[model samples]
Target: MKQGIHPENYRLVVFKDMSNGDAFLCRSTVNSKETIKWEDGNEYPLIKLEISNTSHPFFTGKNVLVDTAGRIDKFKRKYAKK
Candidate 1:
């Protein structure tokens, strides 16, 4: 265990999975301008996540494809042959 090496701004933050609307509260130093009322009736910093263990394919044991900003479509269009 090391002292003064860890972040001093660790606070309870809400991590939400946007794909499935799943959220959990945990300590984090990540900054967020958004806030969410948690189940415990407390307001915490909101951190929106594209993929988390709740909705990730590997963690959930379900194969799923996540497309961000239409990257998959862009790639397909770029490689599609006439």
Candidate 2:
């Protein structure tokens, strides 16, 4: 391995804020925000996420609808023409 030629690897926490609940886990991601404290007396940047495995409908054995790119309506419109 070479020195000064590789990106820095640091420890950070990932927080998921889902409709059902919230969770925290250790991960390596890029962030430029200030530090934040956790209940375990550890401090890291506060990263807020919308979904994770805990609350994802597929993982939780429930049905869900995710329409982020308007694909649902696009498919409907295209299929309805035939």
Score every model by TM-score: 0.88, 0.56
Candidate 1 similarity to native, TM-score: 0.88
lDDT of 2 by residue, 15-73 (tens): 74545447576766677475667778888777666667767788879788655467899
Poorest 10 consecutive residues of model 1 by lDDT? 60-69
The C-alpha stretches of model 1 lying farther than 4 A from their native spots are none
Best by TM-score: 1
Model 1 lDDT tens row, 1-82:
9888988988999999998899999999999999999999989999999989988889988888877568899889999975
> Which candidate tops lDDT?
1
RMSD of 1: 1.4
lDDT score for candidate 2 against the true structure = 0.70
lDDT, candidate 1, residue 55? 82
